[model samples]
Target: MDDLIVKTVTKLIIPFIQLYGIFVILHGHLSPGGGFAGGAIIGASFILLTLAFGIEYTKSILSAKVTERVEIGGVIWYIFIGLIGIAISGVFLGNRVAGFPMGTFGSVISGGMISLITIGIGLKVASTMISLFHHIIEED
Candidate 1:
């Protein structure tokens, strides 16, 4: 049954995928993965959850409206943070001028802007994907 497929995928794949997404978000500053990749992975996780749990369960976790707000708010938060760099650092997204103490490479919270942006992007992406799921599954 489709339900079994969805449930199994949700239970098994989501955790690892989400962990990988977090890794992507966290490792962004040191390596290739960044906000975009992290965000996308979070989004994928949500989609899988929705498919497995069904609309009602999904809504329990995140309503479509809430997801929309989260997406918008994340973007706003990201913009605001980036703007701080602009006003002080003299360039957009210029986090360096803000004087964030860059920690050891590959450590969580090591890269300041990279971490902040990754969080913002993850929320934005998760919410966006949830919204998309609501649009598709809510009708069913």
Candidate 2:
């Protein structure tokens, strides 16, 4: 953690890693990567940070309360999106029938609620991984 090389490398690469993760999540509906892959990527970035900087430092950045809230928020967001389908189409996760606009094809925002769902899933997966990592590391 005190090594300048590792710290510098982590600082340099963490942002890009996180950016890629977000990209994966956003493009999940249109591409191969999705919530799970993107979330794992994001979680890996945090893991890298923890490895490079130490648990205490990572804790300062992402406290227990904040992580819990984020996780819960992701779950709530997912449920809310599903509820929209129920309200609109009387079916859970109803896409077009729920009146979600299918935008221009091949566009980033073209997948109706798919993008939103994946975003929520990505958040949940990322938080879950971080939490598990923290717990496992703290088990000592």
Candidate 3:
């Protein structure tokens, strides 16, 4: 952790890792990767940071309160998306029925509410993984 090489390598790779994770999340519907996979990658980056640095250092970067809020917010966002379906179409998770504009096929915005749902899923998964890791570290 104190080594210059480790610090340098971690600092360099962390951004790339996060970028890839976001890419995966954003392109989930178009490609094979989805919210879960992308979120795991992002969470792993944080775990990697914790390993390369120390718990204290990682804590400063992602405080417990912030993590909790993010995790809860993700779920709330998902629920809200579903609620939109109910409110609009009288059905849960209604896509076309909810009148969400589905863009051109195979395009980024083509899936109506799918992209937003996936984003919520990705956020929830990433926060959960980080939270679990943090809890485990704390227990040690």
Candidate 4:
């Protein structure tokens, strides 16, 4: 972890990895990858950071409190979105029937609530991964 090359590489690559993860989460409705995949990618970046830097440094960036909040917030957001569907269409994740505007075909906003759902899932997964990793490290 004291290697200069690793630290430099991690610092440079983490942003791009996170960006790609966001892209996957956003475009999941239109493409193959979805929230889980995107979240895993982002989580891997954090893990890499922990490896290159240290647990204390990683904790400084993403404290336990913040990670817990993000994990809870992701679930709450997902549930809120589902509730919107139920309120509108009497179904838990009703998309078109919920009166959500489906954008033009093959576009980013074309999947109605799907994109939103994936966003929540992505956040949850990423935060969960980070939390789990930290916990494991602490145990060791």
Q: Score each candidate by Cα lDDT.
A: 0.78, 0.92, 0.92, 0.94
> What lDDT does candidate 4 reach at residue 9?
89
- The estimated TM-scores of all candidates read 0.80, 0.95, 0.96, 0.95
In model 2, which residue pairs have backbone atoms overlapping below 3 Å?
A: none
Candidate 2 overall lDDT versus native: 0.92
Regions of model 4 farther than 4 Å from truth:
none
Q: After superposition, how far is residue 44 of candidate 4 from its true place, in Å?
A: 0.5
Native-to-model Cα distance after best TM-score fit, residue 77 in candidate 4, in Å: 1.2
Model 2 worst lDDT run, 10 consecutive residues? 62-71
- How far residue 46's Cα lies from its native spot in candidate 1, in Å, is 1.7
- Strongest candidate by TM-score: 3
Off by over 4 Å in 1: none
Query: Candidate 3's error at 37, in angstroms?
Result: 0.4
Score candidate 1 by lDDT. 0.78
Write model 1 residue lDDT over 60-126, tens digit each, in one string: 8777778888889998998998788878877788766787678886667686677887788877876
Q: For model 2, how does the per-residue alpha-carbon lDDT over 43-114 read when each residue is reduced to its tens digit?
A: 999999999999999999998788789899999999999899999899998899999999999999797899
Question: In angstroms, what RMSD does candidate 1 have relative to the true structure?
Answer: 2.4
Off by over 4 Å in 2: none
Deviation from native of the Cα of residue 131 in model 4, angstroms: 0.4
What residue pairs clash in candidate 4, if any at all?
none
The candidate, 2 or 3, that scores higher on TM-score is: 3
Q: How far is candidate 2 from the true structure (C-alpha RMSD, Å)?
A: 1.1
